[model samples]
Target: MKNLKESLKRRFSESNGGNEVRSPLRVLLRKEVAEHIRSWRFIILLTLIVLTFIASMYSSLSNIKSAFVATDNSSTSFFYLKLLTLTDDSIPAFHIFLSFLAPILGISLGFDAVNSENNNGSLIRLMAQPLYRDNLILAKFLAPLLIVAILFFSLTFLIVGYAMCISGIPIEWQEVVRILAFNGMTVLYVGFWLSIAVLLSIRFRQPATSALTAIGIWLFFTVFFQVVINIAIKAFIPDPNYLSADKIAYYNEVILNILRISPSQLYVDASTTLLMPMVRSLGPVSMEQMAGAIPSSISLRNSLMLVWPQLSGLIAFTLLLFAVSYALFMRREIRS
Candidate 1:
């Protein structure tokens, strides 16, 4: 702790004295990036996710080969993306595996962000510097986010490149665009988890408590949420078979809406839509609505339009969590 403070103090002093200058936020961000890169949590998370990507890609290649042999057609569309979406009996799709594990990256980076420093009393010392008060939290939050984004985006390129090599299929430009959007949405989904973890850090004084709280919430949504949803639905009707056709449709709609309340569900809905342009709709469709509908996969624009509300909900929730975090942090007294 002593050495860290001395180093930071010396760095800040030297920067101010030198002819070259940098913004405080940039300096803080760089420092944080270095710390995160060296942290054991970051290393473990990186290794875990990399191994997942490899396993997923291997499975996808095998599936694509089998699918190709089974079909007479040699021209397969969106072949590169199947690297992320296609799964064999052994391994699941790349995005499906990612959807389950990606939040851990955010959780690993942010679970200790504020409270750990406060517990060590270093946060107070860091704030004693000439930098604006908000800069600390702002830089802390953004640095991890930027680094996580780069990490995941790089992994995306690796999967796509490998899938290209194995499949020997040419990817369309539009498909490339859609995959890029998929990568971006994946990052955003992880960012939402990171934001709330930071908020929890503000609310809880113990790093362990904040971490456990975040993981608890995550588990509830990922593991038990749908179970609870199904239970609620069953409890309501007792016997879904007794419902009329119109009632069944309404019941399905209610279930879908409730499931979207979970971040995991929203990510799945949005990521699948983005990666698999063949997906036409995420919600209930009336007979009239589907009467004139084309059987083919929809365009990227159409897919985006269909999932815009889900995307918006994810973004809004992230911003709302960050806003609450900032408010709570700003209200906290350093003496406490």
Candidate 2:
């Protein structure tokens, strides 16, 4: 700890003496990123994610051969995307695995962001330096977010590269665009959880409490929330067995809307739409609306339009949590 403080002080002194000046936020951000990278928890989390990626990729590769054999040339349109969205029963698709694991990663990175420093008495000492409270908060948030972006993007490109090597097929421009969009959505999804973890870190003094709270919220949304929704629908909504077609469609829409309240659902919806171009709608579509619609895959523009609401919801939720965390941290009293 003494060595780290000395290094940071030296860097600041050197920067001040040189022609180049470093912003306090940048210096703090670098410190945060370096600390996270070096932490044992981060190492464990990264190993877990990499192992899952290997399993998912193996499943995807094994299925890809059969998938190619079964599909005609026209149906093989998004072959590269299949590498990401395809999987056997034993393991979920890469994107699906990401949907489940990424939140945990984000939460692990951020659940102790503020409280741990405060508990260790570093928060007060750090604040005593020539740093604004906002810069510290922003560095705490942005550092993890930046690390997440790099990790996700690196894994995504690795998948792309591996798929190309095995399949010997050049990826389409549209597929590239779609994959990039999926990566961006994933980063945002993880950022949403990161924000929640940060919020809890600020709210709770004990890091353990905040960590468990974040995990509990994750479990509810990932597993039990859907169960709760199903029970509510069964209790309130009329049984679909005797409902008219229009009523059934409306009922399904209601269920979907309620489910979309969970960030996991939103991410699944947006990612499915982006990766699978055949998906035309997120909600139930009546026969009348589908009567003239062709079964062909939609264009990238149209797919984005289809999932724009889900994407917007993710962005809005993430920003809202960060804003609340910012407000709380600014008003917080840090005593030496």
Candidate 3:
């Protein structure tokens, strides 16, 4: 084993015209990132997101104008955050735009990541190089993730800048931290879908098949899953309106917990908690728990504490899907 390892290091070093050996993951990552940046799918998604940003900014500006004129002065000091979350007559808020579009971007970047390369005979050739199997699969998973991060972060900063310019309000430090954290959480959410899509890519040799599979799952969760869950809940727990408040609350809790199993629901819960500081709780809040609770926005730390389980769930799902993809890829034969 040691002899083979030394031979590979020597061979790879000599082949790359360097005395020291280096991991091929970086080389693969750079190549994949460049490809992703140049892909039409990425371009289309970015363009759509930018258009949403512009529309959102326009409507947000109008909304913020009205908000500032209101006499209540009830908005927390972090009013600037509202510029991105609030919607007006015509356009959705920035976060709303993201909740819908982020999955499509993830599927686009990952649905064909592996199979397209296989179709073009690139995978075998790339694998033919002096690289370990782990390096190939890990980089394939990460490069798209990094690309998604770039797209998300760029859009986030652009929205923030536009909000600042239009609102004319300097965002507070705590607000900036929350926004930055929200960006990271959004990245993780999208990256989870990316990993799932890539797993489909690895499982299906046909790029179109993998792409369709990913889109089908997205549609199921986005549109039909809630309806299905409602039907199931209704069938199991009939006449909830006739029940007492405690019973009704328990039924709703059961339904909500079941719904949270879907990735989209989890993403929405976490995003809402992070972006909307006024959201006191995601789960059932009994009257006792709500007693004496002022109707006010909480600090960033408290908000994170509320949503940490959600963030962790997203992370776990992403890692689990990636692990499956890695295992499948490692077991696959290039020659076959």
Candidate 4:
């Protein structure tokens, strides 16, 4: 008890005028972020990211070079070009790479964010400090988001560098800014998923269970949900062969709205629109393509705005999950 009192007094003295100077939340956030960076997991994640990017660049370099060679002419100089013209195929490759890999990176970095601390008993020690119980959860959440931002930027730089080197062209300011904007959106999208992982970590005391839960949820949303949603839509809409054109249009709009509920699908739809010039679908597209595919339903800005609802939904879901964990932690009794 004496030690506890002295510790409290010292903590108070270090605080600002009886109020905590550095919130426990901030400390926890910083500590978690630093720990993540220093850990082998983070290093492995970075290594994988670099490796994947290198592989992608290598695989696509031949095609990109061929395209450049085909287009190379005395009249059209690679220099003095204001923008790197993105072919439809180029855009799809980015989407494919991000979709398959970004979530893995996010989940790996964050699925253990809180559960590990709890398992190691550091969480109890952390709460003993002059910090609110919920601060640790909040910090865990913030740490993954920061890491997401950093990884996204690093990827953006690498992609741009590769593009410049392969094209043997100077990247324009506008192109750089556009790439940054796309990457910024991607970071937020990926961070939203990481928040879900954080929420799972907080909910499960066992790190392995928490990670498995996160992965399960990801698979359901990305893979199973997609199938279920498509089937439901198809069953209800049923080709609309007997419907009027206006009715068909209305049905299509409704289906689209419903589909956008899944962020991954929203990401696919939006990215396709945003980078239509650079994107290409790998699987067999419907007859709609051969017949001159309908242009994207929304422009890039509009598509972005449209995705805000889904984004908000994801963020709110994460926050709600974290809040529940925070409340539980606050009520928990730490045994000496």
For each candidate in the order shown, give its overall lDDT on alpha carbons: 0.81, 0.88, 0.80, 0.63
Report each candidate's C-alpha RMSD, comma-separated, in the order given: 3.2, 2.4, 4.4, 6.0
Candidate 4 residue-wise lDDT, 114-167, digit = tens: 678778777666666666666666677678778878877776577667667756
Ranking by lDDT: 2, 1, 3, 4
- Window of ten residues with lowest summed lDDT in model 1: 67-76
Please give, for residues 236-333, the per-residue lDDT of candidate 1 as tens digits: 76476677777878888989999999999999999889887777888887797879776666777899998898899999999999888888888889
Per-model TM-score versus the true fold = 0.90, 0.93, 0.90, 0.74
Compose the digit string of candidate 3's lDDT tens values, residues 1-336: 234345555556666555333446666676677777787876887788788667876777688776565414675766756766777757667777888888887888889878988898877767766777888777777887787787778877887787678667677888888888888988888888889898999999898899899999999999999999988887888686689888888888888988999989988898888878889988788898989999888988999998888899999999999999999998998872
Give candidate 1 regions above 4 Å deviation. Answer: 1-22, 67-76, 286-288
Off by over 4 Å in 2: 1-22
Clash count, candidate 3: 0
Q: Which 10 consecutive residues of model 2 have the lowest summed lDDT? A: 16-25
